[model samples]
Target: MDAVSDFDPARYLSDDLLERIRGRAAAVDAGNVFPDDDLAELRAAGYLAILVPRDLGGAGLSLAEASVLQQRLAGAAPATALAINMHLVWTGVAKVLADRGDDALRFVQEGAAAGEVFAFGISEAGNDLVLFGSDTAATPQPDGGYAFTGTKIFTSLAPVWDQLGLHGLDTTSEDAPRLVFGFVPRTDAVRTRDDWDTLGMRGTQSRTTELHDALAPANRVVRRLAPGPNPDPLVFGIFSVFELLLASVYTGIARRALDVAVETAHARTSKKTGRTYSQDPDIRWRIAEMALAYDGMLPQLEVIARAIDERADHGALWFAKLSGLKHRAVTSAKRVVDEAMLVAGGSSYFTRSELSRLYRDVLAGQFHPSDPESAHSTVAAAWLGPVDPA
Candidate 1:
């Protein structure tokens, strides 16, 4: 059962489906493989096309609705939710652009409705200049298309993605140092390495992708913007949706931990007091802290996502807000999971325990975009101004 009761994920996700996903999560994680079964079920339910317009044969949900659904899904299976997030992010970006009167990503919305699975391919090993720069080479073809040749790590949905939405640096172009955003289909030039061995989120199978002259055809080449923080709608759209969706996932994990902790507190009795841990002051306080953190996230996430959908202006503070939200969700989730472990006592420490799995899963939250250091720096720059190179 989910922690949230008032909202029903806009009816896009049914409780039965979520329960089925939850049932498969442990097995998937144990095998260290992708959740192919879950994916098939989600696709069959038209969940993949939820963001696509109704005219395009979709559920036509808003960003706020999407966030709620992602949270609900994450509560059941964090890795499944995380992996599907990549696909939803692309569709969500398309929605953001369409709302701003930019149809450059119209193909993405249409593609989603047509049963295509898109994956995110942006991360590079040793490259901290995320979303601002790229190490991959974007070579312009004679037909106005671009051929990408480089590696992208942590490519989620690695096993089943039909399209890889990625970016690369195009130094050879007329506008030198431009970052090219495009999509490439799986071809001989593109390869996915089976190197997804990890401590947690093992079900994601977020392997490394090798692009050796992988082509993004002219029509699919979406945007070419100069590197560094520009006010392009694409940038804001990606940043806003990515951060909000990610926060939703971590927040869901925290909610799950809190629920388990509550259950443990009521079910376990203390030897000294001859009563349940629910009566203990320390356990009660811990549960309250977890509840407070989980409660705190929804309002901000709900407001921000609704604001984006409504096209409200946050101006320059948008990045700071988004980054801060992601950071808070991750940190709070870690704290909640830690407290949950303690409340459950020694049995929770076992690998077979649900709390044990959650503990491992929540750790991956800190590793996502907007890490603690970067998030603090962003918030600091927003208020105190950027640091001087001198």
Candidate 2:
């Protein structure tokens, strides 16, 4: 079989860099601390600008390339990849808009090139409405700026993000129900809580945020659209970048777990058979199953990413496709990790083992947006039509 070749993730994330991040993964997980040094190194390497246009002093890579690089990074440190995923989400959205000839988010690209970090603040406590609704209140000012009031949960990069891209419900105007999307800089109105203690992906420092009339200047206010699912370009831009990049991270986790399983199968021997576990039919079959599950995911991810980059239109089916890709990648990755643990024997059960950490880390994929239930509903509606409102 011919190898799939278009973009190599290692080109941006070199082996040496991967090793450096890998060396810190265990410690970060144990300490439940953010990967400060890792972020600095990635910043210095210009990874933060991977999706920014070349004219803006960035690497100018496409979404396909960014997805590949993220998978490679996640294989080494899932938390780092996941945390940085928030920043990349904004940049990727900018690229999507620019490709469609709407450059309203040029500030995001310019800020990224200048080394400014952007964090996502869309997720709210108990607000499964996702992009369709916002619990945060966006009050309009005479100067045209917005003062957003409310709390945001799971605010990744909380400790270090320079600007926050967020959304809120605007109830002040005659329209009265527009979802206002904008960027707010780190200032007195914004506060980050030191409450990031979690079961896994500890390095992300995804803490809770309190906003007391946090201000987004008029120029930074990007979109104000009617709340609900609509064909707005901003919605498409956000969903496409968010889902694809997220899928890439979990896919990398699967790759690493599969590698560990292979190594363990070769090294561990069966007492009665007097041979390596690799030679055992049951063990080999399990490994093959893992391989089969993981192999199917990469091509799906790559195809969707390439479609986004090439500006190909799937029209109404785009949401279902993107959500399905994310749902499948994470579920497959979790399955692969489970099989790997069994193949690696009892040694992998220890907390210090890399596979052990991955076991916990991959579980986080289930909590991300476009989750399994949501993905299934989207897909079913696309094929079978929306259920009648009786």
Candidate 3:
């Protein structure tokens, strides 16, 4: 059975589905390949529709429930999990825009349901976690549509994404700094360049996309929309969901590493002591520390999840609280996985071993925007009181 069968938010997350995803995890990581098969499974299982309303052919599960399901799946396969994460983020934002009478709603919803993947085109040119960059211009075409011409790096799922959730500034209206939010279809004009050969998340296929006058309707673009900003109530809820669930995945991978290490310990003897390595006190302590780290992540995640549910009736302050928990979960998960690797030593580095891939996969968790640095400014600003209207 799936680890979260009874409490499953949507019937989309099933034991059979997880098994299929797990089978591909190692192969994808080893070959540094996208998990196309796993994504197909997710589509078939309706995971893509978890947040969509039932009237719209979705499961319509709440933020609280969805977090539980995501956490379970992420604990097993993080690459696939992260890929799915982008989908939800874009879809959620699109849902709101559509409700705001944005013309692109129908296409966005239908496109997502049809497996037309959308890459969240955030984190623009020259972006360094502080300043957002984008020299790529969006100019109006005489045909009433806009032509998007720019370059975006670290574009996740770009290789297969059919649409892009683009963020840009509409310079045409000088009176207002119109921030454009909309979908850009992957037409012949959209070119992708190889760029995302990173130390981790290599399989995300996070390439750089170059757009040259991609055509789209005026209604297809909504100006003055922020994709996802800090301190929003949903931001905290989603951040907690992301950090804790990713941590859970690392913890699961670490447990697997620990399992392999213990089995090896039982079979091999220490060269100096002439005794099985499993019997060594130092070795035992290392194993114990790994377990402690793994065990700690679960309860901590639960605490944050529960808080989000309770505060849903209120406004955004709860999200700020969630940022703290997210930082802790991400940090603890990295430490656990690191220690798990140490227990296995050089053997864990072997390509044939599962621990090798698990180690590499867990490292990606560190850079997943879960740190306090991202949220410190926002949370502190809220605490200091509101500024005057200048």
Q: Rate the local accuracy (lDDT) of all candidates.
A: 0.90, 0.93, 0.63
For model 2, the local distance difference test gives 0.93
Error of 3 at 329 (Å): 2.6
TM-score of each: 0.97, 0.98, 0.77
Q: lDDT per residue, candidate 1, 290-376, as tens digits?
A: 898888888888888888899999898999999998898888889989999999999998888888889999999888888888899
lDDT per residue (tens digit) for residues 94-138 in model 3: 443343454345665666666667676655555543112246666
> What is candidate 1's local distance difference test score?
0.90
Model 3 quality (TM-score):
0.77
As a whole number from 0 to 100, the lDDT of residue 99 in candidate 1 is 91
The alpha-carbon RMSD values of the candidates against the true structure, listed in the order shown, are: 1.7, 1.4, 4.7
Candidate 2 lDDT over 26-111, as tens digits, reads 99999989899999999999999999999999999988888888888999999999999999999999999999999999999999
Residue 106 in model 1: lDDT = 84
Give candidate 1 misplaced runs (Cα > 4 Å). Answer: 1-7
